[model samples]
Target: MAPGIIEMLIVGFAVGLTGALAPGPTLVAAINSTLKSGWKAGPLVTLGHAIAEIFMIVFILTGLYVFLGEYSLFVVIVGGIALIVFGALTTLDAKNASVDLSKSPDNAGNPVVAGIVTSASNPYFWIWWFTVGSALLLTAVSGGVIVFLAFIIGHWAADLGWFTLVSTGVHRGRFLLKQREYRILLTACGFFLIGFGIYFLISGMNL
Candidate 1:
């Protein structure tokens, strides 16, 4: 038997958390904003991320779905390769990255806009939407719009939960996430992405 709405939701949440934990521009922005603006930045950034995702979801559902359906294998292969490259780059970046709270911008604009712009500017964001995200949406759609909506909610919930936790911890604990801890966390996330990328590559080849 096929999975139900709950299962899809769980899948969505897992995927979202994985994506959020991965070191990326948006994650950087979230951390930066939080240091400057406090814990409130977390939710605001997520809200903006969600807004950007909403439009992306709609576009994938309506227009990109057709093209993806036609070239599914090719798209998956390219996406998988891209993921591998991204993983490598992330790993390298983690080794050198340092979080200097002292450098936090004093004039960082609205967190919501920061979220939207950061998300939009990232090429990987669109790439994931086209490949992994599109595939996930197709699965969710099998159960109906409501199920798909639930998947979206689950995904955003992970984003919100993670960013909020990070922001709150940074704001409250202040000394919890040192540069070494940050690098370790990002390195772990990079490995995760690499694992996922390998899986995607294998799956694409099988197709």
Candidate 2:
């Protein structure tokens, strides 16, 4: 049986939170931007992230549905490979990154642009949309359009909440989150990405 709207929302929120917590370009960007600006950076970046997600949701709900429905395996393979490459690149970048807030600008660039570009470049973002996201979307469609909308709202809420907290904490306690700590976190996230990438590759091969 299909899950109800409430259940769908809960599931969406949980999944979204899980995705958000995972170390990725988006998280790194948020932290870096917040360090330069303030807590407001978090929400601004999230706004861009949310916009990208909204576009993906619409595309999935529309004509992409037919493509995914028919060529599911193809989509998986492509997405999986993309994840692997992205993961490797992310790891390398993190390893060589310099965390120097001293040189950071008061206002680097538009958070919205940062969010959009960061999100658009991240391969794992698309992978999630193609895999877990696609599953949630299918379930939501089964329940109803209202359920789908609920899922989107719940997911985005998680993103906004988590990033807001992160940015706020960083902005308030910048000294606590020093350069070394930031690099460590970035490195950890990079490894996590690589692990997820390997999993995706295997899953794709199996498919």
Candidate 3:
């Protein structure tokens, strides 16, 4: 591959890995879907997440990229409120976290839908993609469809790898379900998510 292509791929993978591993609705959805269905559901959920990211990136790159500069204050305020609410909810959920494997025959489709909805509905995602993702794509390549597509593939691959590992581990070690320490860990993750949300909100306001 050309040097530009190689660089874009690396950037794609890095962004993908970091974003995929970040604590958020998509991650929670992955965990829930894995437990609800099975390993097979993991990839489908990941695909949905990737699809949402791709859509967001494209939307921002197009003329639809409405610069929120005029509404920065409003956006910041809204984002802050969302973060606080989301964070509190996440912390509460973690406190009472438990897997309910009860599944219906028609529930197979739920994981995919859940993944899509969670990813699409996340306000954080909209902020990140519009601000960061669009910038990356604009700088991805001066010209080359192959290179752009490769970037997308690399990004998606990272998400797929992460979801696969997370679900596989959770499925294999159901013992985490029985351990109080694990519950604490989940709670910590929740707290951290809230912290992250608050940070984002404040950062938005200052911007």
lDDT winner: 1
> What's the candidate order when arranged by decreasing lDDT?
1, 2, 3
Better of 1 and 3 by TM-score: 1
Model 2 ranges with Cα > 4 A deviation: 68-107, 174-207
TM-score of model 2 (CA atoms): 0.67
Give candidate 1's whole-model lDDT.
0.77
Task: Give TM-scores for every candidate, taking all chains together and pairing residue i with residue i.
Answer: 0.74, 0.67, 0.61
Q: Encode model 1's per-residue lDDT on 1-207: one tens digit a residue.
A: 323688778767766876786666777777788878899999999999999999999898888777666776676676667566766777788898764444466656889999999999999898788766876676577568888888888899999988887778778856366778778877876676677668766755675
- State the lDDT of candidate 2 residue by residue for 1-207, as single tens digits: 444788768756755765665566677677878877789988998999999987988888786677676765665556556545544655566555543333354445777778888898998788778765775576577667888888888888888987887788778865345556555665565565556546645654565
Q: Give the TM-score of candidate 1.
A: 0.74
Worst 10 residues of 3 by lDDT: 99-108
Better of 1 and 3 by lDDT: 1
Q: Spell out the clash pairs found in candidate 3.
A: none
Candidate 3's residue-wise lDDT over 1-207, tens digit each? 222677667656655665665567776777777777767666888878877776777665564335543554555565456545644655676666654333333443477787889888998778666554554454443337767776777778888887787677667755233546545655655565456457646655554
TM-score of 3: 0.61
> What are the RMSDs of all candidates, in order?
3.5, 5.7, 7.5
Clash totals, every prediction = 0, 0, 0
> For model 2, which pairs clash?
none
